[model samples]
Every structure is written in C-alpha cells, then in structure tokens.
Target: MSSSFDKFQKRRLISSYFSVVLSVFLVLFLLGILGFFIINSKKLADDFKEKIAMTVFFKSEANDSILKAFGGELKTAKFAKSYDYVSKEAAAKQHTDIIGEDFLTFLGENPLQNSFDIHLKADFVINDSIEKIEAGLRKNIMISDIVYDKQLVNLVNNNIKKVSMWILITSIFLTIIAVLLINSSLRLSIHSNRFIIKTMQMVGATKSFIRKPFVMRSVKLGMIGAGLAILALIGVLVYLEVNFPDLGILDDKLLIGIVLIVVFGLGILITWLSTYFATQRFLNLRTDDLY
Candidate 1:
C-alpha cells in the first residue's frame, strides 16, 4: 500500500507539471501571434506609404540635356526609393491602352507631358517631409509641376496611426493578462508543494538550497514551454507561407527572428519570475498556513 501511494503521488506530480507547461505554452503562443501581427501591420503600412508616388511633369520645351540632369538628380536623391521616367510618347501609349482608343489621332499630337514617377521611401511619406520634398523639387527650372494625392497620403497616415494605437493598447492588455494567468498557475503548483517546503525548512535546509531545485525545475519547464511555443509559431508561419505566398511570411527574416526572440524571452523571463515569487510565498509561510 505504501509503494502504491508513492507511485500515485509521483503520477500526480507529473500531471501537475504537465498542466503548468501546457498553460504556459498556450499563453506564449497567443502572445507570439500578436507580435507577428504587429510586425506585419507595420510592413503593410510602409508598403502603402511607398506606393504614393509623386509625378514630376516636365515643361513642354524641356530638352534632352535638362531631362538627363534631372534624371541624374533623382537617381541621387536621398528621399527617392525609385523613379521611372515616362516620355510623352510612352505616356500617350499608356493612355491609349487605358482608353481603348488613340487620342493622338483626334488631337494631332501627344498631349501628355514627360514626367518622372518618383516613389518616395517609406520614412519620407509623411506630410511635412513630402511638403519639404515638393518645395525643393519645384525649384528646378525644367520641372513644370509635381503632383500626388495628398488626400490619399493623409488617409493612409491617419488610418495607420489609429490602427497602431489600438493594437498597442490591446497588446498591453493581453500581456498583463498573460502574466497574471502564468503567475496564477505557478502559485497553485507551488501551493501544492507547500508542505514539502516547510518540511525542508524544519530539517535545517538553507533557503537557497530549497529554492535552487524548485527554481531550476521551473526554469526547465519554462524552456520546454517556450520551445513548444516557438515551434508552433514556426509551423503557423510555414502553413501561411505555403498556402498564401503573397502574404510574404517567409520573406522578412529579421522581423521573424525578432518575434521568435520575444516569444522565447518572455516565456523564460515570466516563468522564472513567477516561479520565484510563487515559491518564495510558500517558503515564508508558517506551517499552520499550509493547511
């Protein structure tokens, strides 16, 4: 009967450990998902910003020398990501394709101006930056006009700010909840072993000695949980990459690395701290409080 009881206790302890690990895995997985979403949202915002190109039209009499000089300046511009020159002929051809008719036949000449469609870097797409850029570009003698949808730029910027704010708020709230839940699980697990701690203390075991094993065990469990969470995150990313290639899950290695580090770091750090506090609570309690 004594041997059977000991075996039963061992199984129960194993079950408790498993439960803690499982709880931590779930929390960390959700946190990883949120982190991935936040990173991708930023990428999407930049993509939108970069797509708002500024079309710089040239004067009707602008010659090849002026065009070449302007093109060279655009190539070396600090704010420009890329630029594509569209001659009047090419522009008219594009217009013809769009309208499904040759406008040049009726007009007797190509009316489109030679222009350079300049795609700005993501960081320079803001209102102030764009205004400054336009001001500087307008000073060119051969440039006729610079045009882009200022309204579209404002819309994208405003919507991004709003979405980012809400995402930040939600992330903070969920992180707090995750910590509390993980801490609660650790406390309960520690609580179950309160008598063992008290007994070790009564036997003249040093506090450090008592803590070392529990802390190490908890750290190991935390590592296991974190590893599992990371694997799950990777699996999800793989599935997304395979099924929806356009989302570009596998393209940004740096962002994915950061997310993985965060998930693993949070798992280890939170679990260690929660376990330390949870174990300390039991270690400080009176024997009578163990009941």
Candidate 2:
C-alpha cells in the first residue's frame, strides 16, 4: 500500500506538470501567430505600393542616347525601386495587341512616344513624396510629362495606415490575454503543490531555498513549452509557404527570428515570475489554509 501510494503521487505530479506545459504551449503558439502577422504586414503593404507605376513620357527630340543616360541616373535614384524603358515601337505593338487591331496602319505612323514605367519604392509612394519626385523628374529637359493616379496613392496610404493601427491594437490586446492565461496556468500548478510547500516550510527550509526549486522547475517547463511552440509555428509557416508561394511572409527571416525569440523570452519570464509569486503565496499561508 505504501509503494502504491508513492507511485500514485508521482503520477499525479507528472500529470500536473504536463498540464502546465501544455497550457503554456497553446498560449504562446497563438501569440506567435499574431507576432508573425504584425511583422509581415508592412512588407505586404510595400509590395502593393510598389505595383503602382508612374509613367514618364519622353519628348520626340529625346533620342535613345539621352534616355539611356536618364535611365542610368534613375538606377541610382533614392525613390526608384525599378524602371523599365518602353520604345515607341514596343509601345505601339502593345497598344495594337490590346485593341486587337493594327491602329498604326490606319494612322500611317506610330503616334506613341518613348516612355519609362517607373516603380517607386514603398516609402516614396505617398502623395507628398511622389509630388517631390515628380517635380524633380520634370526638371529634366528630355522628359515630356509624368503621370500617376494621385487619388489611388492617397487611398492606398490611407487604408494601409488604418489597417496597421488596428493590427497594433489587436496585437497588444492579445498579448495581455496570453500573459494572463500563462500566469493562471502557473498559479494552478503551484496551488496543487501547496501542501508539499507548507510541509517544506514546517521542516525549517528557508523561503529562498524552498522557492529556488519551484522557480527552476517552472523555468525549465517554460523553455520546453516555448520550444514546442516555435516548432509548431515553423511547421505552419512552411506549410503555408509551400501551398501559397506568393504570400511571401517567410521571406523576412530576421522578423521570424525575432518572433521566435520573443515567444521564448515571454515564456521563461512569465513562468519564472508567476512561479516565484505563487510559491511565495503558499509559503506565507497558515497550516490550516492547506485545506
């Protein structure tokens, strides 16, 4: 009967620890998902902004040599992400293909002029920055006109700003929830061991001496839970990327690394603090309170 009782108590202890670790893993996994979205949101917005191209038409007098020099200059421009030169003939051909007819035959000559489709970097896509860039581009004598949808630029920026603000707020809210849930789990685990803690205190163990083991054990559980969460998060990302290659969320390796570190850090920090306080609570309780 004595051996059986000892085995039962050991099993109960293992069950309690498993539950605590599982709880931590679930909470941290959800937090990791939010962190990933927050980190990649800006990159997604940038990709959308980069697709809004600005067309720069050149004057008839502007020869290929002048355009080539301008192209070289644009390559080094701070605002420009990329630029593609379209010859008058190429433009005419594209137009004809779009209309499904040879308009050049009827016009008797190609009316289209040389142009460059400039894709600006995300940071320079706003109206004010674009206006400055346009003013600078117009100063070039070879350039005839610059055209882009100003309203569309404004819309994109406005919508992205609203979305980013909401995401930040949501992330903060979810983080608080995760902290509470993890803390509650640790408290419950410590509560189950209250009798043992009181027994240690009665046997003349110092508070620090008694607290050290619980703190260390909780920290180890936290690390294990975090490691499992990280693995699960990575598996989800890999599966998503494999199926939807264009999402590009996994492209920013640095952000992913930061998210993993944050999950692990939060796990260890929250558990250690929670365990310390929880053990301290039991340590201060009266013998009768063990009931």
Candidate 3:
C-alpha cells in the first residue's frame, strides 16, 4: 500500500508540473500575438501617413521661372520629404496611357497643367498640417490651385486615431482577463493539494515556509513560458520579414527589446501574484473547508 501511495504521489507531482508548464505556454502564446500587433502598430500608422500627399497645380500660362521658384521654395520646406515635377506633356501621356487612346487628340492641345506632387514627412501628414500647407500654397502666384482629397485625408486621420485607441483599450481588457483566468487556474491547482497544506500547517510550518517551494516553482514556470513566447514572436517576425520585405523597415530593435522586457515582466508578475494569492487562500481556509 505504501509503495502504491508513493507511486501515485509521484504521478500527481509530475502532472502538476506539466500543468504549470502548459499554462505558461498558453499565456505566452496569447501574449506573443498581442506583442506583434503592438510592435507593428506604429509602422502601420506611418505607412498611412506617407500616402497623404499634396498636389500643386500651376496656372495654364504660368512662366517656367515662376514654376521653378515655387518648386524651389517647396523643396526647402521642413515638412516636405520630396516633390515630383509633373509636366503638362507627362500628365497628358499618363492620361492617354490609362485610357489607351489619344484623348489629347480630341482636345487638339494638352489641357493638363504642370503640377508638383508633394510628399510630406509622416509627422506633418496630419489634417491640420495639410490644410495649413494648402493655405500656404494658395498664396503663391504660380499656383493656380492646390488639389487634395481633404475628406479622404480627414477620414484616414480619424481612423488612425480610432484604431490606436481601440488597440490600447483592447490590450488592457485582454490583459485583465488573462490575469483573472490564470489566477483562477492557480487557485484550482492549489485547491487539489489542500490536504498537504493542512498537514504542513499541523506540523508547525510557517506560511512563508509553505509558500516558498510553490512560489519558486511558479517563477521558474513563468520564465520558461516567457522564453517560449519570445521565440514564437521572433519566428512570426522573421516570417513577415521574409515574405513582406516592406515590413522589414519596421523592425525596430529598441521596440522589440521593450516588448520582450514587458512580456517577461508580465509573465513573472502574473505567476507570482497568482501563486501568492492561492497560497494565502489555502492558509486561511478552515480544516472543514478542506474536506
């Protein structure tokens, strides 16, 4: 009977250890997905920002010197990333190429005016800055009109703001849910060993002494989980970089390091917190409650 009991106890111990390991793996997997999004969020926002450009249309009869001056001034602007000078002939050719016919032949002359396609820095791609730049361009004598899809720009800006807020809120909500779920799981795991805890108490074991081994085990499990999560995250990032080279620009080392730190810290914190609370509850429970 003693040998059978010993074998059963050993099995239970191994099962509990594996259970902790599995839980850690699950937690890390969830965190890895979250971290990938959070890390790439800024890159996504910058891509949207870069797509917002300003078009400066010239007067039909504008002198070449006047157009050159306007382009030169815009080139010196702090917010301007680059500018493309689109000649009337080039614009007409573009239109013809798209239509696959000579629309210019019907007009007998190129009706398209020479323009500058202005690309702005991501920081200055906000709606207000674009509006301000448009207003500034209007004061130039060479400019016949400044054309941009104001509504589209506004929509993009608003959507970015909304998405950022949603990401933050969702991350927080999910983290809280994760903590609660892990805590409950730990409590249940500890509850299974209530008799062992009671027997320790009867033998004059202090609460700290009783909690040390469990806490140590929890910490070790947490570290292993965090390491697994980091590896999974790196694998996903590697896959993205290989398949989508454009995303490689967003592989910021600093941001990735920060994410790893946060993941490890979160794992340790959650594990410690759950273990502490579980042990506390066990210590406070009545002998009758154990039954």
Candidate 4:
C-alpha cells in the first residue's frame, strides 16, 4: 500500500511539472511575438520618414552663384539629410520626357524652374516641424517657392502615431491577459499537489521548507520553456530573413542577444512569482480545503 501511494505521488508531481512547463512555454511564445513587433516598428517608421521629400523651387532668374550659396546653406542645416539641385534644363528635359518632344518645342523658353529636392531627418517630418522648415527656407532670397505634400506628410505622421498607440495598448492588454492565464494554469498545477502540501505540514514542515522544492521545480520548468520558445523564435527569424531579404536589417546580433536575455529574465521572474504565490496559497489552506 505504501509503495503504491508513493508511485501515485510521483506521477502527480510529474504531471504538475509538465502543466507548469506548458503554461510557461505559452507565455514565452506570446512575449516573443510582442518583442518582434516592438523591435521592427521603429525601423519601418524610419524607412517611411526617409521617403518624405520637401522641394525648394528656385527663382527663374536666380543666378548660379546665389543658387550654389543657398544649396551650401541647406547642406549645413540640422534637419537636412541631403539635397539634390535640379537645374532648369534638367527639369525641362524631365517634363519633356513625360509630355513628349513637341511640348517643349511649342514653348519659346523652358518654363520649368530650378529646384532643390530636399530630404529631411526622420524626426523633422512632423507637421509643425515641417512648417518651421518651410518658413526658414522662404527667408532664402534664391527660393521662389517651397512645395511639399502637406497632406501626405500629415497623413503619414498621424497614421504612424495612431498605429504606435494601438500597438502599445494592445500589447498591454495582451500582457495582462497572458499573465492571468499563466497564473491560473500555475494555480491548477499547485492545487494538484495539495495533498502533499498538507502531508508535509502535518509532519512539521515549515512553509519555506515545503516551498523550496516546488519553487526549484518551477524554475527548472521555466528555464526549459524559455529555451524552447527562444529556439522557436530564432527559427521564425531565420525564415523571415531568408524569405524577405529587405527585413534582414532586423537580424542584428546585439538586438537578438537582448531579446534572448529578456526572454530568459521574464521566464525566471514569472516562474518565481507564480510559484511563490501558489505556495503561499497552499500553505494557508485549511485541512478541510485540501480535498
């Protein structure tokens, strides 16, 4: 009878350990997905920012010397990424290419103005900042007009802001839900060991003495789960990199190391927290509640 009881207890312990491991694995998986988005969003936003161009059209009668000085000044500006000076002839040729040969022949002279194609830094693409940049450019005597898609820039900025906020809110909500789910799963796992806890308590085991083994088991389970989740994440990253070379920028070694460290740290923290609380609950349970 004693031998059978010990065997049954061993089976129950194994089952509880597996349950905890499975729950930790799921939590880590969710965390990995969240981390991927948070890591990539900034890069995507930067790429979009780089594409936003501000055109500075020069006066038709602006001399080469004045235009060169203006271009030099623009290069020195803090927000200017780079600038391309388009001469009147070049602009006319581009327009002729679009409209056909006879269009420019009908005109006595080139109607197209010289212009500077300006690329601004990512942070400077915001509406208010662009307004300031436009005002500053208007002060330049050589510039006749500053043209940029105000609506497009504003739309991109607003959409990015909205998406970022949505991601933040969604991540927070999902994290809370995941924690609760993991905690409940751990509670169930602990409840399965209620009889053992009661038996230990009856045998004069202190709360800490009874908690130590369970906590250690939880730590081991969490580590295993975290390792499995990390392997899966690595696989997904490799697949993405292979399939979409454009996303290869996300394969930075330092960033990958940081993600792995976060996953391991989260595993340890969640395991410790859940196990500690579950053990406390078991320790405070009455004999009648053990069943």
Ranking by TM-score: 3, 2, 4, 1
What TM-score would every model get versus the actual structure?
Answer: 0.79, 0.83, 0.89, 0.80
Pick by TM-score: which candidate is best?
3
**Candidate 2: clashing pairs of residues:** none
Relative to the unseen true structure, what is the C-alpha lDDT of residue 161 in candidate 1, on a scale of 0 to 100? 91
lDDT per residue for candidate 3 within 51-119, as digits (tens), equals 776888998889898888878887789988889999999999898899999897778888889999888
lDDT, each prediction: 0.90, 0.92, 0.82, 0.84
Give the per-residue lDDT digits (tens) of candidate 1, residues 123-184: 99999999999999989888889999999999999999999999999999999999998888
Candidate 2 residue 3 Cα shift, in angstroms, is: 7.2
Q: Once model 1 is optimally superposed onto the true structure by TM-score, how far is the C-alpha of residue 55 displaced, in angstroms?
A: 0.7
Instruction: State how far residue 185 of model 3 sits from its true place (Å).
Output: 2.6
Off by over 4 Å in 2: 1-11, 99-109, 236-258
Q: How much is 214 displaced in model 2, in angstroms?
A: 2.0
Candidate 2 positional error at 222, Å: 0.6
- lDDT (C-alpha) at residue 105 in model 2: 89
Candidate 4 matches the true fold with a TM-score of: 0.80
lDDT of 2 by residue, 11-61 (tens): 988988898799889999999998898888888899899999999999999
Off by over 4 Å in 3: 1-15, 248-250
The lowest-lDDT stretch of 10 consecutive residues in candidate 4 is 247-256
Candidate 3, residue 247: lDDT? 70
